[model samples]
Target: MILTGMIFQFNKDSGEGLIMSSKGATNEFSASNWIDTSCEPSVGLKVSFEGSDTLINIEVLKDESISIVSDNKKYSASDEQKMEEFSSVDEYIEHFKSLGYKLAKDTDDGKVRTASLRRFLEDGHGEMIITSIDSKITVKTMVNGKEVK
Candidate 1:
């Protein structure tokens, strides 16, 4: 059984991530101490806590909070093939997913085109704005209200 946890930093150097299994801090968090070899954990991912129940440091779980650790992840790459895949509207929808965006909701405002990601912002505060289609190979990131071209 492959263990799965929210992967933070992929230590290609060590071939592991700082996994926070169900048995958290009670177990040492050292690289040699990573207990599971499941799917590589993606930062900011909320997955199952797939270890046993036991915590070492009473407040140590705080260190394993994936979200808090993910806050510092400055960037991620999108699929180049999915950028300009607007051959059809359905393809356009799939393009969104390919670009690391989720299909939150689909509603017909009685229109031919869909208003993708009504509230698409990287953290709700608009810290990043990904304005690109599946057919384009370029991704422009907007940070602090400025476009980083």
Candidate 2:
């Protein structure tokens, strides 16, 4: 069977490692089991191998890259692609919050503290404003604060 998992542990001196499969099983692999891979296995990198409990023919999985434009802009080509992917507002808000965003709070001046927070979200090119007022919540999704139309 072909199993996919992340390299849980790798001993560079020994060229042997253990892979923790998505099914939550760890299997040992050695350099001899390596088949077709250009890169060496490292801990936490996803890998594929064919085996049962004892994995063999281990190979590192390669990610297909999409060519993205690089420029001195707030949004990279990849960021723009991520911004356009939210099918709903909740998914959009959760993604940004996971990247470290606090709830929009009120300041001493009676103004919403969204200015600095706006920069936090905009830095990733996906603007997500979450407002909670008296138990009701509002989620505003935008690309740099202007709603995508």
Candidate 3:
């Protein structure tokens, strides 16, 4: 789920903080939960994030307008994209699962199927979600929080 909030309080030394959501709920967060660590967060900074109950993704909001403060290459979701053909949906899932990714979500209709898998790579981490219509499948990948085509 996505939630918008401002930093309620942060202890930079300990890398821990609380986010005060618009709904008046406060949730604890950690620096380690940040996907884009280029800009260290400060108290009172408005942020929108998505994550499970324990983890948070601040980039889905940061990338929309806020300029990142990193000196490293700007992470664009579309950079270095590639396309590959898969013989079947099972083939696609097996390919990524074999590489140590775990299935995150899977759904199917009579005519279409979809699945998402994720892995924390040693050098770069990524999520792969594939959708299949009949025998044709399209795969989308996000590496180090940037999407690849």
The model with the greatest TM-score is 3
Off by over 4 Å in 1: 1-62, 67-74, 77-82, 117-149
Q: Could you tell me which 10 consecutive residues in candidate 2 have the lowest summed lDDT?
A: 64-73
* Candidate 2: tens digits of C-alpha lDDT, residues 32-136: 788865877776666667888677778765442111212213444344345444544455455655544333333333333232122221123234565544434
TM-score of 2: 0.40
Query: Residue-pair clashes per candidate, as listed?
Result: 14, 0, 0
- For candidate 3, write residues 51-138 as lDDT tens digits: 5466478633454433432222333333324334668877878777765556767999888899987553222445688998867888
Most accurate candidate by lDDT:
3
Give the Å shift of residue 58 in candidate 2: 0.8
Q: Which of candidates 2 and 3 reaches a greater lDDT?
A: 3
User: Which residue pairs in candidate 3 collide?
Assistant: none
> Which digits, one per residue and each the tens of the lDDT, describe model 1 over residues 45-110?
323333344311222223345443342322333333225624555565565554444443344443
Off by over 4 Å in 3: 1-84
Q: What is the lDDT of candidate 2?
A: 0.52
Better of 1 and 3 by TM-score: 3
Model 3 lDDT-worst window of ten: 68-77
